[model samples]
Target: MSDQSALQAVIFDWAGTILDHGSRAPMGAFVKAFAAFGVNISIADARGPMGMAKRDHIRMVGQAPAVAASWEQKYGRPFGEADIDALFAAFEPLNVASVRDHADFIPGALETIAQLKARGLRIGATTGYTRPIMEELMPLAAARGYTPEITVCAGDLAAGRPSPLMMWHAMAQMGIWPAHTVVKVDDTLPGIGEGVAAGTWTVGVTLSGNMVGLSAEELAALPEAERSRLRAPAEAAMYAAGADIVIDSVADLPGAIERISASLKAGKRPGYR
Candidate 1:
């Protein structure tokens, strides 16, 4: 294989991609944070902006048509930056507190990390989570043996996912270059878009991430057909978001990597039709 085709790094997203099955931490926090403002947001509403910076996420949620209507009716004003700030302030501590409780590693995460490390692949991470939130979750993840060489959080950069900046920062900090030589694994549309914008191959995980909203045990209890039925929309959305591949979880990542390696060897870029 040519050097250009040899993958060097894997940049993972936090929350859904690594810890937090169903990416439950932030969703609950988002719902409660909005509720605190007397504006109720459903889980689907919170999940809509899953992979962006928290402030951006809050802004998007506030600007959602239904949410905006509720905000106007309740407060007699349009949702604006001040509203975003207030919501974010409310969200911060709730997210920070909840992240620790949800920091259990996704199934196969440890094994995948070990395999990637064994293959000498560099490990780095990016997240929509802010530093304070990560500060709480990282130690717990570390205790479970899943520390990445670097973690780039939401506020660490001037911008976050779907912008390519955070992913670029993670790669730059790790001294890994030529973005195509890295693969990004994430579960959210913005997360996939980040990889695509960064010029790396992108893989999206559906069932284990926000798409299915089921824990490992919960998912295991479902029949295969039921699981597939639930996962279809996320899978389609991932492809629509320009993911090169989509899998049920990180458990299937190695096989996806093999397929991506073959494409790399064939001189294909991400999102190749």
Candidate 2:
């Protein structure tokens, strides 16, 4: 819920926040892209830089120690821009194809957005995906009843997450104001960092995003203790990245927003600073 003295917009990160369940699309594409180059990366390698633009993500994975060693062994040299370019080229098409297959909305995502809108908060989104990938994804998501007022993609600005540029861009395009009046809901450290940088309230989503990395069915299959064991590291990482609040998924979003709105009314704001 919101008011004149409370929160304004709710900016979401696409994959884990609104859809894709476990943020599975890019991971498969990443693994396959690197494997195409004979690099043979694991899921961790594919996920370690989960919130970055795909090329930057590939670059980050290439710099991982195990990946570096593998690259040197295969290419007779270290990974560099040429390798990043090649890997990214391989990644994009596969990512687009993979996204086409995995755009299902996270449970409660549609309902959460509806609740926010009902409370007079606008819905916006940002993503680490490029335009081509988003171009393929938006229609599917829209058909499922998610049409955000604005969606800023990775390459929409000169910089993306952790830079605050995309957040600022989205706010500007949406004609909303005062960074602290907005809430950034995301599941990755870089995404949280962007909110922190932009002075917006940051909400980290644990289970539904890349950090927990399990599909809805898979996560539900885990015992509560095992689930906590898995969620510990991810939740800690979000707090470490300056999240103002953390919740299990968008299902808990209403409570989180209500808390933030109260904080705004109390003249408190994002506290990480």
Candidate 3:
């Protein structure tokens, strides 16, 4: 769209964008595991680090002594190796089952990606889920017939979202330069920030199954102004991380392209206010 040289690739985020995973699964799993250990945590507490790697998520939860203490006080049992092991074990099966059985491709996702690919744009994806999880889902995705040119998974790399590692790695593997030719789309602040830090054009998508992970009905019930607030966190985070623009959804992407192209055509620096 820009200098032709300025926009050669597009990187997408998985999870909420490509898959329709309801909040019930993760929230229920966390509550059950914490309950077994005699602790209680709200879904809000659990949502704080949605874009972090699995191990980091676990470590973050463990760092809260009060949460661990609540579990110990309730069950008269410590959150020792056994509890941690069981938690991880249960986490995989519960989530994988959903991916294998209940996974719904997001509305318009397949079509939008196909359209972008048809335009000769290189495509890739980055996810906070581990390599094993990705492996389990790949065949399913292949069966569904949507393939990304590259996929950067959690444990495959040393760090996760909020860090530019996964995105930078994906770009390198795809042979795309960050500054002149890439766009990154994501649903979370950390993921958006990662793309911005990598100096790629970053787009933020906001909707029901993200951030707070609200239900569609619940989201729809909210006033339009309240619903608009959903995109603020991503926009602020991306702007701080140096994003050029933040769009509300993937459907708005063509306009985003036009804006960036116009700027580049006008010889402005490749960023926005």
Q: Tell me the tens digit of each residue's lDDT in model 3 across 59-85.
A: 556446777777677768765666666
lDDT of 1: 0.90
Task: Give stretches of model 2 more than 4 Å off.
Answer: 1-4
Q: What's the true lDDT of residue 191 in model 2?
A: 93
Q: CA shift at 153, candidate 2, in angstroms?
A: 0.8
- TM-score for each prediction? 0.97, 0.97, 0.81
| Clash number for candidate 3 | 1
What is the C-alpha local distance difference test score of each model?
Answer: 0.90, 0.90, 0.68
Report how far residue 245 has shifted in candidate 1, in Å.
0.8
Residue-wise C-alpha lDDT for candidate 2, range 51-102, written one tens digit per residue: 8877788889999999999999999999999989998889999999999888
Candidate 1 backbone clash number: 0
- Give the per-residue lDDT of model 1 (tens digit) for 1-273: 326878999999988888888999999999999999899898889999998999999999899999999999999989999888888999999999998789888888889888888888889999999999989999999898888999999998888889999988888888887888999999899999999999999999999998778878899999999998999998999999999999988878988989898898899977885
Candidate 2, backbone clash total: 0
Give the poorly placed runs of model 3, Cα more than 4 Å off. 1-4, 21-28, 64-86, 216-226, 229-242, 268-271
lDDT of 1 at 149: 92
What overall lDDT, based on C-alpha atoms, would model 3 receive against the true structure?
A: 0.68
Candidate 3 scores a C-alpha RMSD against the true structure in Å of 3.5
Q: Which pairs clash in the backbone of model 2?
A: none
Superposed Cα deviation of residue 65, candidate 2 (Å): 1.1
